[model samples]
Target chain A: MKLTGAEILIRELIALGANKVFGYPGGSVLDIYDMLYKNATKITHYITAHEQGAVHAADGYARYSGKPGVVIATSGPGSTNLVTGIATAFLDSVPLITITGNVPTALIGKDSFQEVNIVGITMPIIKHSYSLRSACDIQRVVREAFYIATSDRPGPVLIDIPKDVQQELADYNQNFEYSMPAKTIKIDLHNAISLLLKSKRPYIYAGGGVLISGATATLLKFAEKISAPVSSSLMGVTAIPYDHDLALGMAGMHGRYAATKALYDCDLLIAIGVRFSDRATGNKDKFLRQCKVLQIDIDRAEINKNILVDEFLIGDVKEILDSILELLPENKNKSWLNHITKLKNSHENLLWTSNNSLTPKSIIESVRSVLGETPVSTDVGQHQMWTAQYYGFTKPRSFLTSGGLGTMGFGFGAAIGACVASNNQRVVLITSDGSFHMNLNELATAVTYNMPLTIILLDNNALGMVRQWQTMFYEKRYSQTALDRKTNYVLLAESFGAVGFKVMNVHELTVALTKTNKITDKPVLIHCLINQDENVFPMIPPNGTINDIIIR
Target chain B: MNSKKHPIFLLVHNHYGVLTRVAGLFANRGYNIENLSVGCTEKPSISRMTIVVDCSESLLDQLLQQLRKLIDVIAAERADPFNSVSRELMLVKITHSPESGGQLLEAINIFRGRVVDMAPESLIVEITGEEDKLNAFIRYVEKFGIIELSRTGLTILDRGQVSLITKSNNN
Candidate 1:
């Protein structure tokens, strides 16, 4: 259909699978807004109080959907306001298609009121960006922005359209021919198979990229065939079924003592679709000095990016894995499996003995029993670590947490997005009290959409992670980590037209979860009043090696 | 003995003011660049950099050991000299004039590059490869105006061969 740039904006959004956008119109984008108003029935645009919230909402949408979430805003402050959200998405590896209204083309670079070079400002933060220089370029830019957002390792892509471009007329009916680069990541199949056959202690450590590239089945098959235990990054929980004997739980900060220790003692490490972040490595010098590392990642940049690998394969996990399975060597390391089981048993026993307080493991177990393989998202903090440690994730797309950026206040909106995207499949958000407050306003959006997510608020009433560090390293000199203020969350939930529960004990938590499962009309918040001094132990302090882990 | 090539992870404070400073340092040093990757670390205030440069093995080691002395650098380490995971990101704008569809498809098939977007007048082909591969593709398509190009430096890992973090004691 031949249409103006403004009409193309609306039409392209529909083609990109955008049913709704979070944004507010302004003078700079008034023409586009007028076109949007006419097509309001086909698209829903929410006018948020702040552009930051709008961008974050879009980010939230992308996190759960694994698609480019769309956001729109006016020029100047409106475009600049989206920077924080764009940067957040950039850091956390989110796919967002953010469209910002720019000053009229002629006014650009003339310091027109509310004019800024948003494309330049955001270039560093986004995967790619575009400024609509002409009306004829709108369709191509929109299509390419989506491509960039969804390609390779997904991230935010911006399209800055000037006001004049929106008003200019153009033919918008164009089919975008899209094909992603398919470079065959070279895998040394013979060597990979041989190393697997030779290892006495072998383990599979999976990460978020496994889910991104749809390699969960291949990973599972490889693990089962080799009888190797599997450890997951925080984002990798869902890659393997938690009940499987080979599943060794999460590895990193707040990871199971057994899992972390197993990583230290393992002979061979098969890292698939994972970028060993600092949190996962603890200290590079002590992370994997003895083990032969086999790294498989689609992005060549990731191979040997941080920690060293003995054999690096630059290919999609699924393809490389299929090759390994085909090049099988007939050798089994029984002793390695036995040792891993022994370590796991001892670790489980230790966790059982250490249940002196309301720990994360207990909470995760409770939630799991109620919501098996349900999608759970978490904000960053001690609570995030706890969720990672305790939650037994079994299905792909089951656990959604930000590991790379560790962006606080990411869970609440993401939970809403997950709920919306997954057809009301109980999206549970495990958030810290501190993080919840940062984007607590998103509760209204959840209520507006009537999303039936169950939010578990770990109320330690402090920045627990920071407090733990201060307590251990700073001689208990409590700095700004203490959150002294209090707001009755039960009352807050009620105010937001959602169910609320305050849990202090296991029984209370179980009861609240049961209640949550029964009621699906609106979201639910269960505030668990946990110990104030709880610390995530076996922590490799920053720059400290695994040996220096504080085992209290 | 030729100094062995090593891996270096340089963590710098995250600031727009310093990216140019770092990139300039590498560009100005006349170092035979191999690979460089920069991304945000777990901490918001710092960025983790993975750089692979082939020099006299001794010089590479000595240079990294000295990188730790910079104030902007939070930490610098020769992550792996022998085994490591590394990759680079690139965006190449290749121009294939309207008359060269046959040549364009041939080039695409050869490099395994994808035609992400195209106008009636030109085509933008996207390819990710070793520096040499990209360079070769660029050479083949030089007839088309190289409108623009951007690249993410490089990122690397040194744990075991397969996983993000190794299960070994070093991890």
Candidate 2:
């Protein structure tokens, strides 16, 4: 059959099982939008207020659904706007297909209106990019884009279709075929298993790869079978239930004291799907000073990129874990477990504050208790660390935050996406005032969709994380950390036609949360004014070793 | 760390802005490209680039991996200095006074170079050889009052039938 390039692209997306596309339209993409309008019934096109929001929504959807998210935008500023969101997806390994409309083939370099070399601009960040010059290449490009975006270490792939190409006629062969390369899994577990057996204090450090490969169940079984305690990176917090006896919660800068201490004391470290990021290991030399490291990751390049490992396995985390589970005997390390328990108990009493001020910790605890298993997304900074430390994530994909890039303003669009992807499941956005102000424009998106999202705004009236750093290290020279704007968040929410509540104390917060929980039709924002002087604790200062951790 | 000069070769799709992408990758990472040469391959659709960088072995490995990860790049590998066949082209213009013309000609013949073009006061000599050999030729020509010089950086190929095309296909 013969069809326009735009029609073929839409048909290909539908064939690939993509039911939703997030985009904002422009002149260069008019033909594609026309085709999308015709096929609106088959696929829902979400028109976000900005291109960044559109891409972020797609990113959120991909993270939530474990499938490739689709996004579309026009050329020039429209395509450039997706850069941050694309980088966010790329750094975190979220699969996304970003389609941008370019100027016609002839006018690509002529400086025609809305013409930009988007493929060149995003080459470094994206997994792959294709600039289509002919209509006939659309089918193959679309297939390749989808395949590359979701295969192996997933990341964003850009496809630039010129305006003329979209309007051009192409022979659409429904039977066109492409085969994905077979994934090869090769691993030798002898050394790793032997190390695990030989050590007195063996610890398991899991990362996002566990969740990405769906190895959480296998990880839990392996941890239980080996009787080893588990600690997670920020990205891996959801890999094991927080309340599990063997789970030591998050590790690294801003990590739980017990978790960091366990890492410091362990004799053998079995790291799975972790890159040993600097933030996760304050000082690489001191992270596992006396421990033999056995690292497992799907990406071979990541094995020794940051911290050297004594033994390594390069393959899918779930498969590797399954193999490890099948190997060898059942053993117990009672003394190590006892030591961990004592350490956990000793540090347990250090997390509370004496004042009655509404804190992020208390707010996170309340939210977790009230909404068990509800997916929570957060922007970067104090609130993110607080949520990672306090929220109990019992399942994978339950907590989504920008880990690698630490992108602020990421949660708003992602929360909406999670809500949509999870079939209107109540999603929460735990964001600080500094981070929330960056993407508050997205509040209109929530109102437009009427998504069941709750915005837990932690308004400290300053860039809390940086301010804390300055206060600690720079003799309290605040600099530009303070955001003294008079923008009323409650009134802002009301302006967007959403319910708003202001809570000053724990009692008021509880009342606001209770009241907001009852209302389901519209999104609600609960503004909790936290103390400006408050800072996230158990912080390891920059370039400091894990041993140099400050408990206060 | 001992920084040794390594010649890295890449076969990429012949597309616009691919050079920018390759150069940008190095620029962004703060890796210095000491010398670079690019041209079309036997297949017009493919282009080959040779980049010489002075860095440690591990850093070189990282650069190779990053280069291979690029979308347009089909294959990337480091050319062994001892085992690989490498050559660079240099064009030098020397002062052609009657007093020095004879010495310049003798030197060019010894270096197996040719006088490609001649003007009244100068002669342009072209020499093709390894970097060290070209440097020697330039040094000898400098005594004759060289007027100008241009050199294409190293272009290398592995010894025997092992080609980048076959290597990329095998992967």
Candidate 3:
């Protein structure tokens, strides 16, 4: 079929399993808007108030759907506006395909109106981006962008198509095809297996790479078969069931004491499918001082790249693990397991109840007791920390919190996305009042999707984490942390055609959760007014080692 | 494969600061490169780069791919590997190194390898390979001194791809 570049691009998107696209029309994208208008029934186009919001909405849809999120923006500011959201997806490793309209090819770099170097602006943040000068290349670029966005270690891919290109006619084939090259770098399987067998106190610290590589089963089997203890990074939670016997919970600051201690004492630290982010390592110096680290990751730059792995294996986690399984010797490390269990039990006392009046941990545990292994997402802040500490994410994609970007307002949309992806699985979002304000407009999106999402507003009336820092380090010189003005969340939910409730205690929480769980037809927002001035304790001071942790 | 093959060596600063500039150029231009390795040179602050690509002599033009931007990558050149005396070290420990002492010794002799370590029951043999030497050694050592082995993946230098200073001064 003969079609315009805009039509061809949209058709390519449909071929890539994309149904919904979040964007807004502008002068530069008028041709695209016209094409979209003509074929609006073929694809769902969402007009968001802001380009940033539109990209985020698309990101939320992608993260939730396990499908690449698609967003569109016009030239200049429309494209620039998506900077924050695109960077957020880049940092959080979300699969997103952002298409933006550009100035006409002739006007490009001629100081044209609504012309900014969007391709240059987005180059650093995205895995890959292109400025389409040729209209004939639109189909190939769109197809490649989707492929790049969904490939190994998924991330956002941008396509900046010139206005003229969109209007130009082309022979449109409704099929997109591209093959990613198989990894050529090989890790010696026998050697890696022997290393595992030789080390007595081998421990596995898995991360988000496992989820992207689909290596969760291999990770679980490797840890279980070796009877090795597993300490997961925040993104790694979904890769392994939290309730598993070998699971030692999340590692690093705000992580379970046992998990951190295990990391500290481990003889062999096998990091699988994870980039060693600073948060995962309390301090880079002490992360694996006593261990021979075996880093199995797909990115070669990451191997022996950061935390200094003694043995670096560059390959997909799934492939490496399978090869290692074939070569491993049948030797059990019973004594090493017993010693680790002993060390793990020593910190059992730290798991005691927090004495703080409005403990975030208490609230999370209360919600967990009612929700029971349900997928939860949280926006960034002290509330995020509290939820990570208390939320039992027993399954993969069950705990969708931003780790790398720590993006505020990510929880609401992600929860909506999770709900959509999992066939209306109960997705509860634990968000602070601060992050809630950032993207609370997404409540409208939730309403539109009719997602079975429950937004739990951890209303402490202040930016809790920042306030805690102010109290501890800044001598309590409070800034704009306090949002004491009430915004009546019940009315907010009602305005969106969803049920809203306020919970005061454990009984109220359970009751409210039960009621929300039943109302799957529409989304529900729960405003749980938590105690103000709450702090996420057991913090490691900036640049401080794990041993320097301050436990309150 | 009748295509011309070239082995390029870019002696750069040991600083990892140059990798992005070098890799970005190739990625942006959509060049399909093969077998690239970067590591520290004999000098403490210098890095040796080994890149292998196949194309016509015009392939040298690909150096415009960010080579000028990198201040740390002192120079880059094509080298002939056949004439260069290249070597790679691999430590292989076999299971029967302890029980089959005669077999282990014979295998080590065949590969001209010396036992680097012995833990009563295991032997670690250090062997250096020149081009196809390591592959041949592995075939022989697979029977005795090879329980585990770690190879510092192929690093090479050219016979005549010396710095311009020496050649220019000589000329």
Candidate 4:
């Protein structure tokens, strides 16, 4: 059938099983918007106040569902605004597709109105990009973009369609040929098995790659077969259930005391689907030095990018775990497990603060009592680390946050995405006062959609994370960490047509949170007041390892 | 001693902005590209690039892995310097006195180079060989005023029946 490029683009997305997308409209995207309006019943398009929020919504959707999320925008500033969200997805390896409308083919390099080279602007961050010149290429390009965005080691891909191409007529068809790059994954478990046999104490360090490959079940089985305790990076916090006996929650800077100590004392480190980021490995030289490292990742580039490994396997993590599960005999390392259990018991205070005063732990504990396993997201700050430390997650993909890029304003937009993807369940956005002001304009998006979301504002009246850094590392300079604002959050939420709750203590917070459960028609902003002196502890100073850990 | 410069070959889809992706990968990763030469191969869809990057073995391993990750690239492998044949084309414009012209011509001939263009004051000598050979030819005639020099960096291929394009496994 013959159809315009804009129509074909919408049809192609629908055929690819995309029922929803997020974006903002402008001059160049008029034709695409017109087509979207006609096919509004087929595909739902949610327009956020800013393009950045839309892209982030797409990213959150992708992260929560493990599918490619589509975000569309127009030219120039509209496209440039999506850069941060695009880079965030790139850093976290989220599968996202960004479509932009450019000036017509005739005005490409002529500096026409609202013309910008979005493909060029997004080259470094995106996995790949395409600038479409012809209307006939719409179906193939859309399919190709989707394929590239969701392939191995997935990330974002950009497609820039000129205005003329969107209006041009093309013969569209459903059939298309698509093939991804041939992945050559060579796996050898011989040396890995030998190293495992010779080791007495082994630790399993899993990361987002395990969750990305949907190998969480295999990861648990593998850990059981080896009788090893598990530690997760910030990206992999929910990979293993927080309640599991062998699971010692997050391990790194703000990691639980037992997990970090195990990373140091283990004889063998079986790193699965992880990148040893600086935040994860404070000083690589001192952290992984004692262990014979066995690094397993799908991307070959990540194998020796940070640290040298004694043995490595480059393949799908699920397959690799299965192969390892088959090759090795089950060894119940009772002594090592007992040692770890003792360590976990002794250092349990590090994970919780004394609840004599109102604190993030008490507030989080109250929220968890009300909401369970609803897929929480967070903005970067002290509250994010606190939630990471306190939230008891039981499944993979249930906890979403900006682990790699650590963007401050990432929570609200991501919550909207998750809320949209998981329709009936209410999603939660945990943000600090400082991070909340970055993109609270997204409140309009949540209100307009009437999304069932709970925005838990941990109002400390200061940037607690950086303030703690200034106090510890920079001789208490304090600097610009103090932020005092006079705007009332309850009134602000009321003006946005959402429910607002002001809570000061644990009882008040629990009561306010219970009220939010009944008011599920719109978003609820729970402004929980707390002291600014609270800081994330058990921090390993930058470039400082086990010896330099500060527990206070 | 370990050599720093390594020539890596890539088979990429022939299209626009492909070079930018490859070049951006190097620049973003802090790897230096010493030289590069690329052109179409026997297949119209596939082009070949022989990029020389100066880095350690570990960085080279990372670079090769990153290059292979590019969607347009069909294959990425480092050229075997010991078994592969490489050549470069250099256009050197040199100016000399009439009496010194005879010496320059003798020097160019010894290096198996020929004059592609000539004027009253200068002549452009075209030379095609390995980088060392080109350097030697320039050294032999450096006393004469060298006006300009341009080179199409090394293009390399293995000394075997199978080529990268023919040997690439798409499956």
Model 3 docking category: incorrect
TM match of model 3 to true structure: 0.76
Clashing pairs in 2: none
Instruction: Tell me, by TM-score, which candidate is best.
Output: 4
Q: Each prediction's TM-score against the native?
A: 0.75, 0.96, 0.76, 0.97
Question: Where does model 1 sit among the CAPRI classes?
Answer: incorrect
How high is the lDDT of residue A99 in model 4? 94
lDDT of 2 by residue, A1-552 (tens): 889999999999999998898999998899999989999999888888788888888999999889899999999999999999999999899999999999888888899988888988897788888888889999999998998888777899999999999999999999989887775665778988898789888899999889889889999888888888999998899999988999888988888888888887998899998888899988766667788899988776786678878998888889888888788587788898999888888855256543756877888888777655589999999899989988888979888899998999899889878887987878999998999888888888888888879999998899999999999999999999999889888899999999999998888888888887887778899999888988888888877776678877
Candidate 3 per-residue lDDT, tens place, B9-102, comes to 6767674235654666556555445657778766889877776666555434445323532335566656654666466778888765346788
Error of 3 at A101 (Å): 1.2
Candidate that beats the other on DockQ, 1 or 4, i.e. the better one:
4
Ranking by DockQ: 4, 2, 1, 3
Task: Name the better of 1 and 4 by TM-score.
Answer: 4
Q: Which parts of model 2 have CA positions greater than 4 angstroms off? A: A183-185, A348-350, B42-44, B161-171
Q: What are the chain A TM-scores of the candidates, in order?
A: 0.92, 0.98, 0.93, 0.98
Q: On a 0 to 100 scale, what is the lDDT of residue A236 in model 1?
A: 80
Considering only chain B, report the TM-score of each candidate against the true chain B: 0.67, 0.96, 0.70, 0.93
Per DockQ, the best of the predicted structures is 4
User: Per-prediction DockQ, in order?
Assistant: 0.02, 0.53, 0.02, 0.85
Worst 10 residues of 4 chain A by lDDT: A347-356
Candidate 2 has what TM-score?
Answer: 0.96
